[model samples]
Target: MTTADYIALALFLALWALYSWLTAGSGSRFFPRLSLNRAMAERRRNWIYNSLRRDLKMIDTQILAGLQNGTAFFASTSIFAIGGCFALLGSTDKVEDVFSNLPFVYYGGRTAFELKVAGLTVLFGYSFFKFGWAYRLFNYCTILFGALPMMHDTNADRAKAEIAADQVIQMNTIAAGHFNAGLRALFLSIGYLGWFAGPYMFMAMTAIVVFVLTRRQYFSDARLALMDPVSDTKDKQERDMRT
Candidate 1:
């Protein structure tokens, strides 16, 4: 492979490694404070409590269930997209040949490149849509949480309601996690297209993509907020206590 191809490959691999590291959880000492379990638990509990208490006004349990279902549908779609990528990989040569046969072919025997580009484009489009929708759902869940008052009468039977809310929030967070994972897979798969250059170049490019993703996960505010629930819950508690 040419030096340029090797450089591209190296960059990709580096990015992948970085992505992995940044997204890694509290299991590692470096990210010990980045755990989101507690916040997610509280959110779920609140959802259930609100449902039981009938505090959600026009928003019923059925609607909440529907929201969950919608997210599931998106996740399923992403899975199909991944399958499509694999299928494209298997039919790479045929895809290139078909495209080459087009009257407008201009790149001169670069049909494989065209196919690779198309595959990556599709994958990225799928990932972006999935992740974007997941983010919106998460925001919706947060708004639902905001609608319910944190304070409950000590004698009120709110345990079940709290549990339900918590469950919903946890599920939403899990959905977000799945969406992020889908994006990661898409990015890695795109990097895999580097195999057209050479095996070593492919490996290097994969690494670079890994590194880029990791850095974003580690340093991005969105990641910090999503992963560290304790701080968020604490803030909520403080607000409730003050009121």
Candidate 2:
């Protein structure tokens, strides 16, 4: 591969590693600290006293059920994606040959090359579809959060209910994070396939995409609002006082 391609590949790997490091922690790091145990405990206590005093057991059951469902969905989708990537290795040569021929192609005498291309294409298609659907499901979870019943009874002690709600939200957020991580893995696998052309180009494109995703997650307004320490601390303090 050319020098440019090598440079790109190096950059991509570096950025990917960096992004992983930056997002590794849920507290004192990353944009969202909502899952920090102390914060969650405070919210749970407030919710319990304010809205779930009578139905605490029921709320706990529902929260556990939601967590199980979300975790299962993510795990199944990720397994499918990994299987698809492994299947593609069997088709690499066919893909390489096809690309080599370019605009007008002839398989010549290479049956193995043809088979490899077909396999890689199928695998890539499966990965793309799985990743796309997982993303849609994650978006649906966000909508589910919005649809949760809001407590309107000012005099009702709702500490338990609030805690249940917080747990549900936290579980959903964790599921969404996992879904994104799966997508990242799929894309990285695809980029690795590009290494057949040469490691340099593979690294370059990977780096560029990684940089874009990191910037969006860390610098975007959505991330800022969620991660804002001042606001988050205030909310935690108020909830603690109420509890």
Candidate 3:
């Protein structure tokens, strides 16, 4: 690989890590702003703890099932992606031949092509592991959910119910954290595919991807919807009382 490829790769990795960190634990003093991921995490906590007061937890169980199913689906997708990358390795000759004739394509030679494929393989592999672990964590959260005191029992000792719910919430959040990491990798792979065009293209695409993701996490309509609007309403009410 040339110096430009190395620099591009480094840029890709650094942005990936930075975005991951920013979207992770929104409680960090460094960020100061909440991410959509963290906001959803709070909702998850509310969901679990709120179930304690309900007579039937069928809804909660179904939510848990949905989480497991979604994780499984992504995990399967990652596996398929890994298989596709491996298949690509076997067809590098054909790919290089095609690159040779395409005027718009930047043929980085066999070594660069192979390196790019290997990197893609690693990305998919990382996503697979993340999803796998997330699935297990969700399973653990299910068990923890089951261990939560029954509605009748919760009525007797609300504190105990709170403690148990907290456990499940933490497990669910951790599972979600892994799932988010995997999803982030999947999104970045789209940009990583740009390497076939050239390192500069790769760097440009990676930056574009990061910008899109950051906007979605921190400045999107989804984040606005998830944010609590009680403060504005409460302030309005206070002003009315003053009048």
Candidate 4:
């Protein structure tokens, strides 16, 4: 409820937006690297396209089931988190007393504390909706995947098969995007907890969280592992030229 508090909240929101923009694949020139999300999206397309070439699709359905189950689990967790936030609000007096006694803690009275709890509730609610929608989209994607032409039909009409496969790929990608958004909110909530301590700690924690996430997206070993080897690509190009 202070000027510093307002500024810290603004910075927190700005950093969240910035991270989203960078990871959504628009900051490639500045980053000069492919993100893990984008790499996995490519893999999703490959997976869908590969299904068009196969007859037995039990494995593909299993993968879809796994994706749906994961999204459902996160959705359920968000609901639980929202309930916990409400419970926290109900016990504000006890928490406020604890905060007052703690060294280096900020107790901004009942109203401010309530507002902070409200914000946390909103974050969890947003995540819940995202995960819920992702779960639905994944279900729809499974239906689309099932509708894809069989191997013989695909061979007869490859163009139609490609179009059908592209549909499945797009649906799967969109579902994944929602799921990632939900996960990001959950991660950022950790930084938000610093606000309960003080605005300065809030800003520092938000910066630290963003730094870690950005590093993971651009520089982590997982990203490096996903990258296609330069030598392999060059060799493939040379082989194509010779052929």
Candidate 5:
């Protein structure tokens, strides 16, 4: 490919790395606010601790099932995406011809096209592994949840019960982290598709994707919804009074 294409790809990867770092809590020292993922991780810990208080944990089991099912779904999707990339590679000659004929398209020739497809396949494969491992971790978390002491046992020795709950919380949070990693790869793949057009388009699309992800992580309505209810209500009332 050209120097511009290489530079664009490097920028795309750098932005992806930076965004992942920020969302993974590396930016906590610089910012007081929590990212959506971090906020949900706290909720997961609370849910696990709360489960220790209940004898019948059918709801907790169901939540674990849901997490496993969602991870499985994304893992399967990643596999399908990998297959699609291979299929595209198979038809690259025709696709290259079409791309070359398209106005404003860079069409970096056959080798470049194949290289792009190969990169996409690797990305999907990586995501599939992340999701697959996350699913297994969720399964382990479910078993750990079941092993947690009943309310009476917890009353007898709250410290021991809390330790067990903490184990489950850690497992669940690790699974969620891997699941988020897979999901992030899938989102970045959208920007990767822009590389088919040109390097400039690729960088632009990557920037746009990163901006959207940053907003959701640090400033979206979903993040706000997860904030403490009392504080949220107070802030809302003050704003309303001012208006």
Candidate 6:
């Protein structure tokens, strides 16, 4: 690959890192709004703690089950994606022939095509690992959730109950974080596929992917719906978009 190709790849990587940082770890409270996922994380904490004082925890258990199941589903999908990348690698000759015959195609030749396929393989590998880890973390979080005190115990001792609930919250949040990361990698891989077209195409498509992802995280209607524009104090309410 030429320097332009390398530069394009670097740009994609840089944008991914920057977006990850921007949306990660709950973000700043007052400047940028909390990412929609992180806003849900706050709700996750509330849900777990609120369950502590309730006699029945079926709802909370069902929520955790859904999280674990979702994680597992994505993990399985990532495996299939990794397999598809390998399938592409094996069919590079046919792919090269197809690209060569297309008048508008970039057709960077066999070596470049191989490299592009390799990059895709790497992307799916990263996604698979993230999803696998997220699934395990979700399982661990479920265990932690189960360890939480029952209503009788929590009623008798609120502090211990709060601490246990906090543990569940942290574990659940971390699992969700890894799940988000895996999903991000999957989305970016779609842009990486553009590399087979040419470096410029790669860079352009990656930017579009990043834009869409960031918009969903920070500015989408779902985010606005989850957020409250009114804070407790009048001045603080004007400053913060969360209640």
Pick the lDDT winner.
Answer: 4
Q: What is the Cα-based TM-score of model 2? A: 0.46
Q: Show how many residue pairs clash in every candidate, following the order shown.
A: 45, 30, 0, 0, 0, 0
Model 2, residue 133: C-alpha shift (Å): 21
Question: Which pairs of residues collide in model 3?
Answer: none
By lDDT: ranked, best first: 4, 5, 3, 6, 1, 2
**Highest TM-score model number:** 5
Looking at candidate 3, the ten consecutive residues that score lowest on lDDT are 231-240
Residues 186-229 of candidate 3 have per-residue lDDT tens digits of 99999999888988899999999999999888767677767666
Candidate 6, 1-243: lDDT as tens digits: 888899999999999998888889434654466788878988888788788877787888798789888878888888887788789889988887799988756777888888887788888888888888988998888898888888889889999889888988998889888899999999999899888788888999999999999889877767776665565243344445544
After TM-score superposition, the amount by which residue 56's alpha carbon in candidate 1 deviates from its true location, in angstroms, is: 3.1
Q: What lDDT score is found at residue 206 in candidate 3?
A: 98
- Better by lDDT, candidate 4 or 2: 4
Runs off by more than 4 Å, candidate 1 = 1-26, 33-54, 57-155, 221-243
Could you tell which candidate, 2 or 5, scores higher by TM-score? 5
Error of 3 at 209 (Å): 0.7
Instruction: Give the Cα lDDT of each candidate.
Output: 0.57, 0.51, 0.90, 0.91, 0.90, 0.83
Rank candidates, TM-score, best first. Answer: 5, 4, 3, 6, 1, 2
Each prediction's TM-score against the native?
0.46, 0.46, 0.93, 0.93, 0.95, 0.91
- Summarize candidate 1's per-residue lDDT along 1-243 as a digit string, tens digits: 346555654666566555555454524566544433333444555545545554434565465556556656655666676566667667767866775566533322455464555656565566657666775676577565555444463126456446545655665666556566555767687567656555565666676766565545444444445543464675445445545
Off by over 4 Å in 5: 229-243
- Residues 55-134 of candidate 5: C-alpha lDDT, one tens digit per residue: 99999999999999999999999999999999998898889779988998888899998998898898899899999999
